[model samples]
Target: MFKYVYSLVFCIILGISPSFSQHTEEHAAATTAGHEEEKFDIGGMIMHHIADEHGWEFTHGVKLPLPIILYTADRGIEVFSSSRLDHGQVYNDYKNEHEHIVRVNADGTVNEAIHPMDFSITKNVATLMLGALLLILIFTSVSKGYVQNKGKAPKGIQSFLEPLIVYMRDEVVKPSIGKNYGKYFPYLLTLFFFIFINNLLGLLPGGANLTGNIAITLVLALITFLITNLSANKYYWKHILLPNTPKWMWVIMIPVEVVGVLMKPLSLMIRLFANITAGHIIMLSLFGLIFIFKSWAVAPAIGVFALFMSAIELLVAFLQAFIFTLLTSMYIGSAIEEHHAEEHH
Candidate 1:
């Protein structure tokens, strides 16, 4: 009876070993195929990852809707809560400019292109509104703490916020905008904090790139440009129009100086947009490695490298915010600085 039991166990072990080996081989092949499918020319892969989509689509004919939110000046608030996601639909076909049509075939194919701006939802607008609300709530709470602790040492939230507030006032506003900087402090402080928070939020997994959008950054930079020029005193324009230079040099320098005025804010827009976009691209590329390499052996190695890049990106997110704020302050300072003081030197 003992011999019979031992023989049964031996047979079972032999059967299991072959089955396990086959399973392992199958898994490896699947991984390799997955990796191969994900691989593309690096440039094409980067472009694919960065491109925005109106919605996500499934393999079947059924379409999933994406939510979009918009704040209209005249309409108060508008939400397009549901819009079908057709993955290759060209909503803005330059080739067919005469018609505003989106073509959908019965076989789950769409010839019309979809635009990201066309989709809208209360949720997406709410996210932006919520972001604004959070900023207001945090600052308001901090302000209340300061009021309650008047003449006494700041504690709790005040302890944390007071230093940053003072730093912005002294280091950023005062040095940049001078004694009359009080008027601009509220806007500058709000802009700095708002940008910093948005940037940090974008670092989170699956977060949208608020700053990476050129349109958004351009609007912000344009505001700064408007504020700087509008705030510029007679002295600022006098220097630009009649720069303190040799007579012959003035002819060349005046046009160049005027161009520089426009170029400064343009640089601000491009810098923020490029940096934010580049960081996102790099992070996505690192993650793509796992999909592109497939094998478990390659996955572990690539994942470690991807993680290292993410960690570095975290620091970059903060640094980019700081750089944007610093440059903005500098531009404001240059616009409002005293020419008489420079002449004295």
Candidate 2:
């Protein structure tokens, strides 16, 4: 178990080491640059670290600039490296403002009138892509292992993920969705691994807060919304439209039921977004204490607490994934459940 944990951590480092190295290098530069020590802004650092950006700082004075694709009315489209706008520099009559690309006027201000469509792959997007690719690679290898060891015991990554797969299927999804669980198992499994992996990545030293981002959470919730409603049996809609309430109360009950329908997905969105974002914010804030105090002594205490929080966050990563999958299964079950009207007694 400890070996597995160590291996997971090692893979995480290999996945994010380049970006982490440069983030540390950035902080290093900020502290040791030129003259007197500057006052550390804990809030700013936390926000900056958590927020998505344009380029990957792979190392000291090095970056893997992602493509910056923009489309405008006059100019159909343009693609270029984000490096062109590094260090507040201008590129092709445009500048990056807080990771946003916009037209620059000749007078050196943003041309607000010109709204260009940005289709660039930001930091979070890149992280999502990387996470997805990693999942593909992992599951692919596991699939191959299954074939190679047909009658033998599971080996390597296959062994590692088998228990998790079985647990989710047998314990969570099966129980939650009952007989129809198999149909949705694939999606739920994919969702679980995607969120779980990304959450773990976000907890890493320089990982992008991909799962913490509201946009990502919102999209996931919307997907759940679609799946729940689209596959819903007549009983589900009937419950919302014609609840077991007095006829006189239909006016109030109907509106409330309608709102509840929308709130399902809304709650999912806010819960995941708020929880993950809050965790990142708290973790970053805790670590910022060391620099804020400007003392070597602060490191030990903060480090211990940060370690504790790291463990909590690690649990949270898995917990959040489970909660999401469990809730989704429940929602799906509720929608498709066979409802028999109460017999008059």
Candidate 3:
């Protein structure tokens, strides 16, 4: 278990690179070079880390350039390193304007005619891939541990993850998803751990806010929505279309039920995105206070509060993941519920 913990820490430390490298490093470079005595803008700093970008800002001025893949009407498809546009430099008539790659003409003017379809791997996308890789590595080792110690007491990584797996399987998924939980356990488990891992990663210094991004949350919600509706029994639809209410009230109940169906996933997406993003914004804002007041006196107070907030955010990270998985199972359980169960009720 100790060795496994060390491995996890190493992988995370390796992956927690700053996002949107171009802008963040450019500003840092300018500040270091004494080119301009610019006023400290906390909003920009917060956004620089929160938003997606082409290059990986590995550490201060040192960027690990990612590949830029774009498709344009004229160019068909162009592939190159993001370093070409580092520090606001334009290469081959393309510019990275706040991480948006746009075509520029000879006079350095933006070309309106050509709209490039960006297929580049951004910061969040990279983090998602990293998390996926980590998950694969983690479970692979755990599987080995289980096999090596089959029927014996769990040890190492298996011992660490087995409890989490068992807890989710029995306490959360089984109860929320009913008897049909076996089939959906894989998905629910994966979703929970994925979000939980990304949430924890986003809390680290210079970590990309993968889970905080709406695009990522929206995908998770949509998957749940699709699974819930597709597996829904006739009774589930019947309850929506023809509720227990009177025929006269069907008009109100039907539309309301339809909206309710859509709202479930919408609420899931917003809740996770808002909570993760808000936590990040608050943390960054607290750090910004030092620059805001231009005094070292406030550091101790802010540090104490930041420490407290970090603890809260840690709990929230797991809570949000658990809530998402639990709610998804409940929705599935509702959709597949037997008519006999309703009759019993």
Candidate 4:
């Protein structure tokens, strides 16, 4: 009787030991899996926001579409083509009641009743448009007020605007493009204010990447390129075709000079694109680190770094706009200078 009791007790202990060990192993595996899942979810969200269009739709049916300003020919000339404002898509019907639905697909599963994209304009373009409108309205009103005042000391809006106008005229326009600066003052002022406002606007959340879009920056650069070449006197062209060089080196040097002309605008396009894109990417990357760790322990540190970056981006916004405008004015100066008169003497 004693021997049988001992055997029974031994079997029970052995059986329960394996079950406990297995349970512990399973628990550890689940914890690791949860951590991994958390990391992947965070990385994916950050990548989606920072990366270019991937055809993803929102559950609320709001999608931000890239604005197409104009199409271009193979040689980069503007091709006039008409595009539909709403692209023939309807979001909702007010007259008749209809159910709003959307569909989502994930990992072989389908989620139905997902809302479609919102057809309304996005915030980015709206912000840029608003900025432009505000500048125009304020400046126009101030100009009218100044004219009405008949050369008396300025007040109110004019008082604030006069200093900026004078600064651009003396510091930027006069110093860069000399005597003939009056002809280009309107364009220079418009360009400076437009870029400055847009750059500042992009710092706001949900703002569109006005300068980050290479196509938009390319158009602006092209304008500067056209203005420079068109404004160039005979002396400017002579230098390009027949530079002050040894007779034998003309063959190599002329082609190099021509290439440099093309490269100048290309540099402008790259500078704005790279600077804006880099700031956004760095911010997103820092935020991504929080999810990768799968703990609140690291979030505060990441947030601090992100805040620091945001501050730097704010300064970059103004600096980039100013530098671009300054360089453009300098280019115009070289083209329209009194080179011919100097050579003739």
The lowest-lDDT stretch of 10 consecutive residues in candidate 4 is: 1-10
Candidate 4: clashing pairs of residues: 61-116, 61-118, 101-114, 102-113, 102-114, 102-115
TM-score, structure 4 vs. true: 0.67
Candidate lDDT values, in order: 0.57, 0.78, 0.81, 0.59
Per-residue error (Å), model 4, residue 166: 1.9
Q: What is the per-residue lDDT of model 3 for residues 1-345, given as tens digits with 9 covering 90 to 100?
A: 112211133234433322323233323435565676456778888887788789877546777788999998777989999999998899989999999999999999999998899999877888889888887888778778977998999997777777788888899888887898888888888888888888878877657788889999999999999999999999999999999888999999999999999999999999999999998888878877887787879999998998888778877878999899999999999999889655556
Q: TM-score of predicted model 3?
A: 0.89
Worst 10 residues of 3 by lDDT: 1-10
TM-score leader: 3
lDDT, candidate 2, equals: 0.78
RMSD of 4: 21.3
Candidate 4's displacement at residue 97, Å, is 28
How does each model score on TM-score? 0.71, 0.88, 0.89, 0.67
Worst 10 residues of 2 by lDDT: 1-10
Ranking, TM-score, top scorer first: 3, 2, 1, 4
